[model samples]
Target chain A: MGSVDRKDILAPQPTAVSESVSPALEIVGLSHSYGSRTALSDVSFTVSPGDFTVLLGLNGAGKSTLYALITRLYAHRSGTIRVFGAAIDRDPATALARMGIVFQQPTLDLDLSVEQNLRYHAALHGLPRAVTEARIVEELARVEMSDRRRDKTRQLSGGQRRRVEIARALMHRPRLLLLDEPTVGLDVAGRQFLLQHVRKLCRDQGLAVLWATHLIDEVGDDARVIVLHKGKILADGSVPEINAAQGTPSIRAAFDRLVQHGEPSQ
Target chain B: MTSETVEIGSVPATGPIRLTAAHYLRCLEGVVRREWLRFLSQRGRFFSALVRPLVWLGIFAAGFRFTLGVSIIPPYETYVPYEVYVVPGLAAMVQMFNAMQSALSMVWDREMGSMRVLLTSPLPRWYLLTAKLLASVVVSVLQVYAFLAIALFWDVEAPWWGYLTVLPALILAGMMLGACGLLLSSTIRQLENFAGVMNFVIFPMFFASSALYPLWRVKESNLWLWYICELNPFTHAVELIRFALYGEVSWSAALVVVGFLIVFMVLAVIGYDPARGLVARRGGSE
Candidate 1:
């Protein structure tokens, strides 16, 4: 954040080994069904490094389903999810090692202290105890919950819990971060903070990010967007590209046109 | 949540990709630590686990003390008190209950989707599940030993060295029961559903086994019922503990318990497989 320029990271650097040419997340011919009801039908997309991509979808639009497949929470039944070129199913250890996720639900253990929850995650990643303690302090400080680390998660407010969750996601320094409706229940300021915080990670660290939300306003003017409706991709491009495809000037209009007609204009 | 602009430390530029034996060991240690903390927090579970077995040993055994007499069993050198006869059964009961209790928690986690946190780990799923089982076994063993210690005051005791010998038997039994719980948990979807399953599993497993009386007693009463008792894995677990407590080994019981453990553990691994097993069908949500 100090003296780091967004424009500097926006461009590719030859020296960055972390910035592999491969997409951070690549899903091809991904189809998942819950019995007869098809949740996602042939869904596919790619989130590149340093890209702030928003998965825009309404309720039951299969945004969560796509997240499930990518995160390996639910298996990829028909297609493939590759993280940093590592297929999740074939080599999940390698694939998952490169990605971090914040599930929509509050997955934190309410009974444990905030610090304990984070430590547990670190341990799962195989971090040493010495490193785990330091990382816990550092991440808690980032979420501004360092003081509340000792308190049980149940004692935290909704926004506080969300912040802790975000902190937990960063413990292992994942190259790609996936957040599903991360700001669903937060206030305006809280939501704004989360969106901006993640955006900065993209701009500053060259991290790939996929932010799934139904709120169109969260779709920034310069961000890439994937509009999912009824488990199919209606649009996948930058704000201007999506807007131009629908002959709309703004993201809201383009998203409205895409959702209202239930068809991809392009 | 703090509204202030909080600065996370600079990203590592590259995330670590290498893992070693230390990582797996750390994970195991962490799981054990979490399980121990949770066990400590749930004092009621520990209390109930002990009280339920003690009731059978104290009231149930005492009531049948004069009415029912246990003859000289191979594990027993001579006629032991009814209280003594029921000790191993009660210990096995503790482990079985612990297994189901741990299973209940797993089902809760899975239903709530919090289990995804553990499942998403870079570690092998089977290893993670085994770590969970072993952790539960540690807690179950603690309860079993505690029950044995308290039974001493009730004038029900094994040889002084029997307590030491029973450790492995207890662990093996705990693992066997825990594996069964894991296999069951993968099929279950709701917390409420677990209650019915628990009753179906725990009661029948306890009563249909040699928990209360010897298989010989059941054989004298009803031949078919005795066959069921003989086939019960809980019976083997109890016998294993009984023999181990007496500084001996029940080879047939040991083999059966070991065989079931392998079968259950393998099925559990399969049941949780996202692609091939019921895991795909269980949580059909996207």
Candidate 2:
């Protein structure tokens, strides 16, 4: 796969079945292991552009292992990742350029201001000075953090920090945003706020988002939720569809069904 | 930016924080800057880096001067003062400290959750590690120059031309130690176990090398000890610095240090490889 075309992702009108549709993210037969312990095994999925897809898994469910492979931090022994349709393994830079990632871990410099952190990230992508400053301001505003630009990241609350991370992830205005547990430390309010903001960002920016989380509440009925367990994806489909198959109306019940049965449909 | 947000103590949440290539460089740049700030914030690491070398140079060298009367080595054209002879060793000491500091920070980073942030960046691991190594080497060079300055003040002098040669020697020595540090950081599974590994690696490497005494000096005690010195990469690092400071090239020393450097770096790269889990631990995978 190459890059997902702008027309495929953004066109207001739908085409016939014969019309080609390109996915923003495509992973097939992905697997990773440390010694004999497999972290991810033959995970396959596609995230269409403008779609908000949530990856549901418990702690140690290989969400990060999959994220690592997608980012190419560690290569999977077998499988392929295509971001915006470009092969991540063959041409990582181009593939990576089209995607934004917010690691589950806090990657910010506590001592530096929020703006400085974004500036540093910008330079890594070789962004020009004027463009970086402009994007920093824009992204900060998007996260409702425009005023916190100068404050040291260390001073920010956990929720504020995660917002900064989300903003930082979007600095390049990527087509796909890969968020690994973006709300791990937040309170109920914080989690709700972050999810709402991220959902809005996807809508406003036409970004395909792969949100990894253990909380079933984070996955909406409209979003595509892939249930991962013990390194394998147990189910893949719309949350409502999966829930219906499991005879559960709520996402929490659906998740319980999937975990109990080890498959959504069965 | 509002005045409230701009307050030094205040944590601002102005607009959003965005990530780009520039942002990544800024992250690394920020790390280097913060490290310098934190390092300088406490005068302890600085003072220790300086004081330890001076203690070795002033007290130990002085006491040993009488008992360890030195003969002419091939590198030294004429008989040199014991202090003068150990200058290269002191240089190696600086490099060693710098390398250990790099390793020490890796442990600290793991503890502080900073290393995870760096690893998870979109940037290549090699580039990130290179930035760190460069910063370590630069800081090490500064410490060495400060030590040299102190040596000059103490009237322990090398040939003027030797100062120029010290630059390359410093680079090689810094790399040798820095790479070793990288390898150790990559291999050691956790910060808690780092001290044991440090003890295993640092003391042996230091004592086995010519840093404390010349190869010939050890040869008099045991031929195997002399062979150990030859095999000790730190010895070559010391020899390289020693020869360079004295306006000569020891081809064997150069070869050993460079070879050690390449091997250390290769090992480090292998250790940090994503598939290998060298530096990738399991404690904080959320």
Q: For residues B33-68, what per-residue lDDT tens digits would candidate 2 score against the true structure? A: 555655664577888898888998999988888888
Per-candidate clashes come to 1, 43
True interface contacts retained by model 2: 0.20
**Predicted candidate 2 versus true structure: per-residue lDDT over A1-266, tens digit per residue:** 22333343322222232435446688889887776777888898888766778899999889988887787666666888877556766656556666788888787877677987787666555565677788888889888899999998989999999999888877766777899888988999889989999888777656788999998778776777889987888877776677778888787887887788773253
**Second chain TM-score per prediction?**
0.93, 0.85
State the local distance difference test value for candidate 1: 0.84
Candidate 1: Cα lDDT at A27:
84
Off by over 4 Å in 2: A1-21, A263-266, B1-43, B74-79, B107-124, B275-286
TM-score of each model, in listed order: 0.93, 0.85
Candidate 1, backbone clash total: 1
lDDT of 2: 0.75
lDDT of 2 at A179: 90
Give me the candidate number with maximum lDDT: 1
